[model samples]
Target: MMNPFELERYFARWEFTAPFLLSASDTEPLAMSELLRLASPEMSDAWANLSLGYTESTGHPLLRQAIADLYTQTASDEGGEPPHAISSDDVLVFSCAEEAIYVSMRALLKPGDHVVCLWPSYQSLYDVARSIGADVTLVELREEAGWAVSASEIEYAIQKNTRLVIINAPHNPTGSMPDHDTWRTIVKTVEGSGAILFTDEVYRLLEHGDAVPLNAAATSSPRAISLGSVSKAFGLAGVRIGWIATRDAAIFRSLETYKDYTTICASAPAEILAIIALTNWSSIVSGQEAIVTANLKLWEAFMSDHESLFRWVRPTGGSVGFPQWLGEGSVDEFAENAVQEAGVMVLPSSVFRHGNPRVAMTNNFRVGLGRKSFPTALDRLGSHVRARYG
Candidate 1:
């Protein structure tokens, strides 16, 4: 199988640092000690008793049940279709969300299948689809429209042979999210076309403003699959817990079958740690939110001053946002110069496959708000841009 190196992966290999950067990265992950310390006092002893062995292929029952609870729409006691009400049978936990995505792509797609994916997205979605010999089409989001993709564009991109439509809400580089109306249009389009929708909701919880609540696609249609994890939103990438939720029994079965050849099951310790994290999810999430909120303030202040050299559509959700350089030279030249002169790293927009010259000439780049002292970094970056372009 001949597959090209994903654009983002290739750029990520060349590292540089600066403030006002956007990349599919996060602040330092939550310390495991901090999580373990949050364990119930009674459970502290139980932690010592954890047996190290191969976890159940599906997932630990407690972990699965906890995850299912997140989808329940109403409070458990109120009994309004528990967030999503998917049975444990419908869930398959993996080493990480990436693994869940990989297995799903491998299992559900065949050579020559067609896939529609959002552009400037997490590269894996398109790369893996292509690796499977699926003809992938990218639906480009408009920068002028807060990087939102139109439903009509998606409809036009769909063909009778298109088997899947992949999307990431609170998207990676742009942090743009569709409103309820747009989402309705997208879901309706997918339903009408009978294409399986793969929704990556790993960053769903990081919305910066009032976010429209959308259920996992798995809950809405038999053809939708939702990918989720504790990494981005919860700051627990180390736990490596991610899952595929779908009401489609065929997809569920196929994924399980393919997993036998890949990772048979997730690690036992990781599962236990994940359960603890979920149990204390409210606190953990709140802590991360506080960090994001503070960092955003700093970002806003920094951007306000450098309006001439930078153009940014403030992210509506997630930790990262893409802001254009709007400079006279290439993003690489600017990025390389910034790294050498400022000792900070920022991802060039070209890295995300906006195309090479687009990467170079285009001013767009990604920034992560989770970094320590991000404000300081942005300040340093602004100085560099002013020195060069101003």
Candidate 2:
């Protein structure tokens, strides 16, 4: 048998951790101790008296209810919809967002299926889909338009065998969020294609402007599966709790059955902590927003001064931004030389599978302004880009 392992091996080479990342996407993780301290007065006695054990496979009711509150139509006052109106029956909590992505892809896709994904995305979507024998197509984001995707382009890409369309909004690298009209067009495009739309809303709560609340494709259509996690906006990656919310009973049932084979259930302590965090979500989100806002101002100023060598499309929302390197020489060469010589780590766009010239077409680099060292790091990057290209 021809082994497929070699093709899959490269996916493991990249690491998104400290010292390797100039734009560490998950570095601004929520402090568990701070959350615990906030909840101490209410649960110190009870938490100390609780037992450690396997939690409900679907998730503890309190945590599920807390998560449900985030959805607009699921609020209690919207009597047309009950508090837990959406299907929580099959909500399977995973260790983290990555696990949920893995399980969901494995359960949903088969070999030779066709999947359409946005380019310069989180690598897992592209690599995982490819690893499973799916024909993956990369739809490029418009650099001129702030890395946004158009519905017409999506419609044009659909093939007879297209089985799934995946999107990350408050997008990772570009931080682009589609307007309501754009989303409506997207939903219409995928509605009857027999293809499911997997929308990753992990950074939904971190909107930089007057962005709308997170939209679960599941709520708007029967073919959408929405993924949310406590990691990004809530800064609680340590809790390792992420869930899929869908109104599609069939998907719910299928993923529930699929869950039994993977994690089986979430940890009790994590669930409890997640529930507590959700209960005070507003406060937690506000604090994070403050940090993002402060750092963004600093980033904006840096980008403004370096327009000749680097160009940026200010992110509408999310913690990161992708700025293109318009240098005179090779983008990858610039990045490699800069990192080796400068000891600064910024992801080259090529890793996102966008090709490079002496200038990488995916020649953009991500800037995560949330880190405390981000300002200094940006200064380092600016100096390097100017020295090489300016």
Candidate 3:
């Protein structure tokens, strides 16, 4: 049996009950009506006459095409040729990104296989590989190093048995993203080792400031797989739509077969909504980015005012960031008290524990930077910090 997912379990207990979910990774979600309003005439008509029957296991054709367009657009921006463009056949939809991870790992790994993955990440990234009896080497990103990924570090971790290398950009919990050259090095390293590169791009298109989104890995390497979802960047978490894009036919067939045992298809309405969101990708993502930009300033001011109590490697991308606790007690205690007394829910580093004792993350807690409610949440947290830490 697989181990319990601590991060999700914590949120399961507090997410709906908490007054302020200060550690949520997704942007403020869009309402159904708001999303519907953005749909094209063709999609509107499809929604009006939608069937509630089970969808094709491969996903809706139009939905797959729309998702494929996302990769193609990014490829084109990078001066890619037609061969680099992702087609609908290269995209396979999953019930959620979590399912995509689970199914993909199941398909690609076996006993004695070696996997390399990032730490303080979504647990499913590594845990599923372990459950399959694969040996996993975690390349831990350090807070002292600004939570950065070192290509050399990853290069050293590769073993002859390594079959997979996983990386999440606009990383969860910390919001640390690698520079373009570093990303290229990582891709090259994984490719040279003959390992499949599985990049979690769920937070793609949410880059802050002048940072442009990286070209989809599926577009650049036949051995690379890019995972994405409407949950984070598009702010449609409730829809439960996510997909994997890859140019590798053999692995694509394996993932497709493995999916047969899980959710055969996604919800019909959710698929329709996802198509609408992807079709208007720019406007939807821009709105989410606007929230992050505004809330980032609020977070900066809060951090500045309470500089003695916390320190963080300011996040350059994504909607969430990790901040270290500089107070007298454990961050776990502080997080518990914050929710019970301050009505703010912040995730402690304990929730990200992956059974690797070498990584000491007790000093950190996650804070989300994309919510419209972030300002109020930060105020509540600030008040609590002063009352307790002082």
Candidate 4:
């Protein structure tokens, strides 16, 4: 049986009700009008003339082309190799990134195969594999180590029967990205072991400061899969558009077939909006980056002021950061109190507990810096912490 999704359940209970939500991972969302304004003349016409009928099961042709363009481009300026350009045929659209993860896992993994996953991940990364009867090993990202990905540990974890290796860059919860050398080493390791690599890249292109974005994994290897969504970086969660890109023709076909069993096709309107957002990708992402950059500065000051109550390792990328709680009570109790007393919702580490018995949970909690309201939320949390902890 598939395990419960505790993180989402916690959000279901508190996300709407909380007065100050400091645990959201996506960048601030855009209004429909704002998004439309960003659309090209051709896309605007498509949206204006859009039919409400079912979309192509694969995806809108234009949307697939736009998504293919994303992976075709490389970040060689960031010191990575030029990607092997992928065409529309290499892209597969899903209703959401969660669906993409589910469909891909169901199609690629089988009973008794070994899988290695990064710890404190979005649960579905490993859980779906387990649901299919695959053996999983979670390599932990420790708070003491600033939550860095350990290529050596990942290499060590792979076994002869390993079929898949999963990793999230600009990782959820922690927001730490691996250095280029480390990332390359991991890709090469998985390639040598004959295991397919699945990289969660929803948080790509949101790297802050001196941190540069890594090349898309699909560009690196034929068997590698790159998962992307407009929710996090483009703030289009309401549209529910996401996709998977790969150079492996067989895996692409497998994912396409499995998608038929679930949401056979994406929402017609969502695909139109996603095309606009992705077509104007640079500008939309720039807006999000501005908000994240400004909010991160506020968090820096807040963390400095309350350094005694939390062990903070500043996140290099993404909108979320996991900090170790140093207060007298457990983080669960503290988070509960924050919600009840301050109407602030924070994700305690318990929500991220790994299914593996050998992997221990930490005292960390996630804080989000992506939304425009983050500064105000930080103020509320800071006041609450000082009033209660001091």
Cα TM-score per model: 0.90, 0.86, 0.97, 0.97
All candidates in order of TM-score, best leading? 4, 3, 1, 2
Q: lDDT tens string, model 3, 230-309?
A: 99999999999999999999999999999999998889999999999999998999999999999988888888988998
lDDT of 3 at 298: 86
lDDT of 1 at 214: 61
Residue by residue across 259-294, what tens digits does model 2's lDDT show? 898888888888888878887888888787777788
Clashing pairs in 2: 30-235, 330-358, 356-360, 360-363
lDDT tens digits, residue span 329-381, model 1: 76777777887787667777766673333342247878888655676777777
TM-score of 3: 0.97
Lowest summed lDDT over 10 consecutive residues: which window, candidate 2? 1-10
- Residue 152 error for model 1, in Å? 1.0
Which segments of model 4 are wrong by more than 4 Å?
77-80, 356-359
1 or 4, greater by lDDT? 4
Q: In candidate 3, which residue pairs clash? A: none
Give the range of the ten consecutive residues with the poorest summed lDDT in model 1: 73-82
Model 4 residue 300 distance off true place after TM-score fit, in angstroms: 1.2
The worst-scoring run of ten residues by lDDT in candidate 4 lies at 72-81
Candidate 2 local lDDT, residue 83: 26
